[model samples]
Target: MTANERDNIRAAMDRLLAGIPLRSNGALTIVRLAEEADVKRHVLTHRHTDLKDEFYARIRAQGHVPDSGRRLRERLEQAEARLEALREENAELRAVNEGYARVVNLLTLENTELDKGDGARVVPLRRP
Candidate 1:
């Protein structure tokens, strides 16, 4: 390829990567992008050294690198944050449940102690 053609191809690749969504539906793969850019699958994989480097450099200049690893890291951070929030919620619920259980136990003990008192007992009579 001529110098200009190589530059154009690199530009196309940069544009394609930039357009990819941050959250994908499924596994992150580059076949669709390669097809869209009219580049072969092997070019995106086995023969992508020059274009991949240029693409990463350009995206990094924009303060981010575009790739599966970066996306996975971002997702992992989000998941960890969600897990932390859930753990806090669970702790709060457990504390509330413990308080309720203690109240129930105390009430039961009081009822049992009252039953032992021998004050005037009024038992209900059943008619046969």
Candidate 2:
């Protein structure tokens, strides 16, 4: 309807002009394209029918087979799976760092206590 909306639709269609391909978030389906452009599906059907037509036509022309449901979810699932793995790795690394910090703190505390031996600590002789 609006010029900005039209531009967003065109941008989305351009991504799919080569037919459905594997996009980073998901497969480049109509639904995902609309999501990418921050537009609704109805916008494509009611107002920007021209872009919609070109999108489907290009898919057919490009010899790229559509998914069975035309809603491939594997790409999104894979991305989420990787995110979860990275989160776990981050937690493990933080825990290891914390453990190292605790060890350093304990050693420092022990050195200080050792320096205060016999109740009255004596300064070590040092050359100027």
In TM-score terms, candidate 1 sits at 0.52
Q: Write the per-residue lDDT of candidate 1 for residues 63-111, one digit (tens) a residue.
A: 6544677879999999999999999999999999999999999988977
Poorest stretch of ten by lDDT in candidate 2: 18-27
Which residue runs of candidate 2 sit more than 4 Å off their true CA positions?
17-28, 69-128
Strongest candidate by TM-score: 1
Top candidate (lDDT): 2
For each candidate, what TM-score against the reference?
0.52, 0.43
